[model samples]
Each structure stands twice: as structure tokens, then as C-alpha cells.
Target: MPSRTPSSALYKVAFLWNLFWGVPLLLAPSLASSALGLPQPAPGLGELHARAGGLAIVLFGWVYLTIGGNPRAFRPFLPIAIVAKAAFFLLVAFVCFFHRELLAMLATAVGDLAFGALFYRDWRAVR
Candidate 1:
């Protein structure tokens, strides 16, 4: 097997990060929201939305894992992943800016920004 590059390692880190938050959000939306310093999600619709978000996050993690396993083969998907990260970060930052109470989410949003930058670096490197 070939040696892994920094980009591969980065994606692996992202995978772990997603799992760290996604699992709890999936399993316990209200509890997870509280743990993350967000107000508890309401029942029914709120919980449903949280669970859906969690599933999306986990799926995104799977994409990162696949890309890490074969960066060249997965190169085409990088743009979409980068866009997703950027969009997530932007949305969170926008919300947090308007609602100070959601400030705790800024950390995770920043993480996505960092990953998006690293992913862009990887895209350039591979190209």
C-alpha cells in the first residue's frame, strides 16, 4: 500500500469529528443539543429535524472516509464536500451572529471551515 498523505489524515480526523457529534444527535437530539450548549430541541418536529441532520452528518463522514481511502478516485467529489462544509459553516455563523445563545456552535462551525480549507488544499495538491 502507498503511504497516506496529509489530506488523507485530515479526512480521517473529520470522520472522527462527525461521529463524535453525529452519534449523540442521532440517538438523543434534545440531550445532544443541551450538551452542545444549544437549547433543547422540542418534541416531534424539532427532534425529527435533529435526527435528520445527524443522519446527514454521519453520511458525510462516510464520504470523507471513502475519500481518505482513495483521494484520487474521489477527487471529483471534493468540490461538493467543500461546498457542504462551507455552507454549514456559513449557516451556523450566520445564526450565531444573530443569536448569541448559539455561540457554542461556532466552534464546530469553525472546525468545518478548517476542514474545508484543508480540503481545498488537498484539491490543489492533487490537481
Candidate 2:
């Protein structure tokens, strides 16, 4: 096989991070259901969250491992991912708003914004 570039190594590392963190989140719904004796979500909802979370993890890995070290290529995806993350947080905000779940709302909103800031810094550094 051809040799991997430094950028590729960076991407691989990022991918591994996602893969490592994502597995648990992927299993969380089922674990929650079983461990907490909570009713399980409909199969569709469970599948959807699993798929989305899995996709996010994979995407994060791809970006981190492949593009992270190559600022030029990585630059383009940064804004898009930030926006997507923001939207995700907004969705969480809406859920919390509707449900009046103060803690969840605070956590999601703050966490997402913090993540966005971190991404922004990374992007700027790369630039």
C-alpha cells in the first residue's frame, strides 16, 4: 500500500476518537431501557437516533483523521459542521423548552455552544 500522509494520520486519529466515544452512545438507548426499566422507544425512533449518532461519529472521525492536519481541506467543512451542531443544539433547546426541562436545556445549549467555540478555534488555527 502507498504510504499515508500526515493529514491522513490526523484523520485516522480523529476517526478513532469518534469510533471510541460513539459506541457507548449508540448502545445507550437500549442500556437505558434495560437498566432503568424505562419503556423503550419505538423501533423506528431508536433506529433513527442510532443511525444519526453513528453517522455523526463516523463523520467526526472522517473529518478529524483525514482533514484535521490539512487545514486547507479541513477549512471548508468547519463552518458547515458548526452550523449543523448549532442546529442540533437548537433542537434540544426546543425540546427542553417544550418540556420545561431546565437542566437538559442548560446542558445541551451550553455544551453545544462550547463545542462550537472549540471548533471555531480549531478552524482558525488551521487557517
Candidate 3:
């Protein structure tokens, strides 16, 4: 493996964070959503959202971990990561803009944006 970059720490942080957030959603959607200040989904919808989102997050988290190991190969994915987070940010912003009280969900988007920025910064530095 190549030597670790300045952003290696950031990648690791994002990896762990994603595990923390994603696993629970995959394994315990109701609990995770409740803690996040999200309303309960209609019966089956909970599992659908939880499992799907969790899978995405966990899978992407693995990608981030891979980047930590071999950024030269994975740094190209940074832009996709940014798009992922930006999508979340925009979705949350739009929803919260109308609901007003569900702003707590924005926290997740904030974290995503921060991690995305870190990835972008490191990708640029390495290039």
C-alpha cells in the first residue's frame, strides 16, 4: 500500500462514522430514526428506508475504507462522494424548509458535507 496521506485520517474518520450511522439503520431502523428525530415510517416503509439507506451507507463506508488503504485508486471516487452528500443536503434542506421542525435531520447532512469536503481537500492535495 502507498504511504498514508494527510487525508488518511479523514477517510478513517468517515469510515467509522458511516459504520456508526449505517449499521444501526440496517439493523435497527426504528431506533435509529427515533434517535435522529425522524418520524416513524408507515409500517413496511420503515424497513424499506432503513435497509436500503443502511445498505447504501455501509457499502459506501466500505469504499471509504478502501480509499484509506489505496487512495491513489480511490481518490477518483471523491467527486461521487461529494454528490452523495450534496444530494442528502439538498433533500434535507428542501424537506426541512417546508416542515421547519424536522431540522434535526439536517445534522446528518452537515456531517456528510463535512466528510465530503475533507475527501475533496485530500484528493486535491494528493493530486
Number of the top candidate by lDDT?
1
Q: lDDT for model 1, please.
A: 0.88
lDDT of 2 by residue, 1-127 (tens): 4433334444455467567645644666566444433345468877668657756766665665555666566688877656755776787677767666344445635655665565666666664
Runs in model 3 lying further than 4 Å from the true structure? 1-4
TM-score on alpha carbons, each prediction: 0.93, 0.60, 0.87
Residue by residue across 10-114, what tens digits does model 1's lDDT show?
A: 889999999987989999998899898888888999899999999999999999989988888889988888998999999999998899999999999999989
- Per-residue lDDT tens digits of candidate 3, residues 1-127? 4643655677788888889889988888888889887876557976887778998898888888888877778778878877887787889889999998799988888898888777777777666
- lDDT of the candidates, in the order given: 0.88, 0.59, 0.81
Candidate 2 residues lying further than 4 Å off, grouped into runs, are 1-21, 32-39, 101-109
Model 3 misses residue 22 by how many Å? 1.1
Candidate 2 lDDT (Cα, whole model)? Answer: 0.59
Model 2 clashing residue pairs (backbone) = 10-65, 11-64, 11-65, 11-66, 12-65, 15-61
Query: Which candidate achieves the best TM-score against the true structure?
Result: 1
- Inter-residue clash pairs, candidate 3: none
TM-score of 2: 0.60
Per-residue lDDT for 2 in model 2?
A: 43
